[model samples]
Target: MKNILLACSAGMSTSLLVSKMKEAAEEKGMEVNIWAVSQDKAPSEMEKADVLLIGPQMRFMKAKFSKTAEEVGIPLDVIDPVAYGRVDGEAVLNKALELMGE
Candidate 1:
């Protein structure tokens, strides 16, 4: 199973996104471990994440997250604004896969 890490300012909004992504994975019969955390906790959680997705509001932190992900050899990206705003789990999931070169 692939492990996906989502980060946001406070983790609250991304938590909702996590649920949606989880549901999307379930519907597609994909086995994936997904979790959401605050930006501050992201670096610590990087080792366990196959992919790192950042929320739009926290997009400015992409460079920082990218550096951490690079150290861990993990793929990282910013979730699309439209998809995130509408909670488009499948779209985001696809984006994650693309980033991972899956």
Candidate 2:
């Protein structure tokens, strides 16, 4: 199963996205573990993340996340704000796969 970790300001907004992504994964019979967390919790969350997805609002952290993800061999990218706001799970999932070079 692919494990994806999403980070946002307080994790509240991203949590909604997690639900949507989970639904999309289920519909496609994709075995995935998607979840959301605050930026501060990311380091610890890395243990289970196959990919690290950041919210647009936290774009400033991309470099940092990238460096950390690189050290751990996990792919990382920012979620498109429009896609995120719309909770477009297919798009988000595709984005994740793209970042992972899948």
Candidate 3:
């Protein structure tokens, strides 16, 4: 199963998106473990994630987390603002899959 991690300022904003993404994954018959954490908790969480997608509002943290992501050997990217704004879970899930070279 793929482990997808979403990191935002407080970790609360992504909860809805996570539910949407889970629905999308179920539709696609994909088995994934997805969760969200605050920026402060993301570094430790990264080690368990297959890919990391940061919230649009927390895009600035990407640079700070890139080094850790590199060390963890996982792909990291900022969520698309449009999709994020709309809470488009399928798009975010697809982005994560693409990052994993799926």
The local distance difference test score of each candidate is 0.92, 0.88, 0.98
Candidate 2 ranges beyond 4 A from true positions: none
- Residue 12 displacement (Å), model 3: 0.3
lDDT of 3 by residue, 1-102 (tens): 999999999999999999999999999999999999999999999999999999999999999999999999999999999999899999999999999999
lDDT tens digits by residue: candidate 2, 1-102: 889999998989888788888888899888988999999998789778889999999999999887788888898888999999898988898888777777
Question: What residue runs in model 3 are displaced by over 4 Å at the alpha carbon?
Answer: none
Worst 10 residues of 3 by lDDT: 80-89
Measured by lDDT, the strongest candidate is 3
Number of the candidate with higher TM-score, 2 or 3: 3
Model 2 alpha-carbon miss at residue 49, Å: 0.8
lDDT of 3 at 69: 99
Residue by residue across 1-102, what tens digits does model 1's lDDT show?
Answer: 999999999889988788888999999899999999999999999999999999999989999888889999998988999999999998998899888888
TM-score of each: 0.96, 0.94, 0.99
State the weakest 10-residue window (summed lDDT) of model 2. Answer: 93-102
